[model samples]
Target: MFAARRFVLAARSAASIGSKRAVHKGIEGTPPMRYMSVAERIAVYGLITVSFLSYPTYLMINLDNIRPKGENSLGDNALAEKERRAAVRA
Candidate 1:
């Protein structure tokens, strides 16, 4: 469900790289404008879907259940260690 929201928001957004770009050619030997086909669009979409699904797993592996572990046990405690470090640096 969360991923559905994320995908819709991302896919529908104008800022997405997959979205069409209206690049115009200049007269100084610039190449002609190129159009993307449905197959190309589908390939880009497939890439986005794979990336979105795999991102959480990558995070879990690196972030240890999406939270710090061992020497940095902030967890639900939230930024307590950060404040302590700032206090020390001050």
Candidate 2:
């Protein structure tokens, strides 16, 4: 009971304080809701693409450690096979 009341009070205080700050002048006295430039959008998309592309690279690196020596691929490898089984649902 006490914890719930305290949480409510804190949330109210935070909302009120945030609204007060929202009125303050942002960078160059401009609000942040403004749209980004075309160049900025392109850079942001490029960053996102790079970030996603690296994900497969990291997974490949970990899986590439033992491709020879008659060992199985990452899915069939003993270690990763256990993990794969755990992740898969019947």
Candidate 3:
């Protein structure tokens, strides 16, 4: 019984990791945030501003959407993209 439980837990963790990897791959095809159009950036920033201002109260009310994506890969891509651009310019 204990071994079965451990197996299930390990399987669950592996599945979560797989999903995060899938999300990361999907993000890689997109242009980084800085390269996005002004309207897109403004919309993103507006939502971020509103989300920050709302804080815990908004999170509590909208638990589903507020949940973080597995690895939040966009931030990683932003830095990577910046470095790539700088390297090209140099």
Candidate 4:
């Protein structure tokens, strides 16, 4: 009896799966920007502008902190040391 009930449920699920239909259809119309008010549009644009500008502004303001400390790959420190030694010797 249990096996028969399980087989019936399996058959029903398989049949229902083949008959599935879409619940929500895609909307076709003008862009959502057309519905926004003037203030909302301005606010959205301002937020976008601030988001783009903030990173460069932050980088410029914290350049000293962001930059690597000490000698770079060019061996500027070694050259400076050599110049100092030469000056001292002279």
Candidate 5:
């Protein structure tokens, strides 16, 4: 209860005091936003295209690593059949 009263008094005292600094005169002192130039636009577009296409490009590059070690081709079911036959023979 004492702490709460002290906190309220502090807040009231703080609220009564005014800041020494004045408020900012917004935008009047600053430059206005403008449209991008052709070169700037091209660079921005190029960056965006690179970011979006990078994942697919990386996946395409490392596609061979996605398959099983001996299965270089997608249709190489024969390799698995041979492995199974070898295991049975063993």
Candidate 6:
């Protein structure tokens, strides 16, 4: 009985899948960017530029915070310290 019910459900799902249709046919061809006003275009381009540049700008601004702990910009003092500790241990 369960197997028959499962078969009925599966058949209904297959029929529903085949009956599916595209509800909205979206705009074809070129995007709507050409229709934008000059100010709108400038604002859109400015936002895009800012978004693209934000990460690099943030990295530059907070370089010390972003770097891994114990790492120095001048050199790898962490490695030297590890070596010194190892020598002391030995």
Best by lDDT: 3
Q: In model 3, where do residues sit more than 4 Å from their true spots?
A: 26-90
| Backbone clashes under 3 angstroms, per model | 0, 0, 0, 0, 0, 0
Compose the digit string of candidate 5's lDDT tens values, residues 1-90.
999999999988776663322233455535432456878878888999999999999999999898667835645697788888999999
Error of 3 at 37 (Å): 24
lDDT of 4 by residue, 26-58 (tens): 354457788899999999999999999999999
lDDT of 2 by residue, 1-90 (tens): 999999999999999999988887577667433578888888888999999999898878888574655754555487687887888955
Better of 4 and 5 by TM-score: 4
RMSD in Å for all candidates:
23.7, 16.6, 28.3, 8.5, 9.4, 12.1
Lowest-sum lDDT 10-residue window in model 6? 21-30
Q: For model 5, what is the alpha-carbon lDDT of residue 88?
A: 100
Off by over 4 Å in 4: 1-27, 71-90
Q: Candidate 6, clashing residue pairs?
A: none
Candidate 1 per-residue C-alpha lDDT over 14-76 given as tens digits, one digit per residue, 9 for 90 to 100: 565543343433464453324567788788889999999897778768885667566745675
Judge candidate 5 at residue 62 and give its lDDT: 95
Q: Which runs in model 1 stand beyond 4 Å of their true positions?
A: 1-34, 60-90
Winner of 2 and 6 under TM-score:
6
lDDT scores for all predictions? 0.71, 0.81, 0.86, 0.85, 0.76, 0.83
lDDT of 3 by residue, 1-90 (tens): 999999999999999999977886656667699479999999999999888888778768899787776865568789999999999999
If ranked by lDDT, best first, what sequence of candidates would result?
3, 4, 6, 2, 5, 1
lDDT by residue for model 6 (1-90), tens: 999999999999988876663333346544789679999999999999999999999989999888778834545797789888999999
- Per-residue error for 54 in candidate 5, Å, reads 1.0
Question: By descending TM-score, how would the candidates be arranged?
Answer: 4, 6, 5, 2, 3, 1
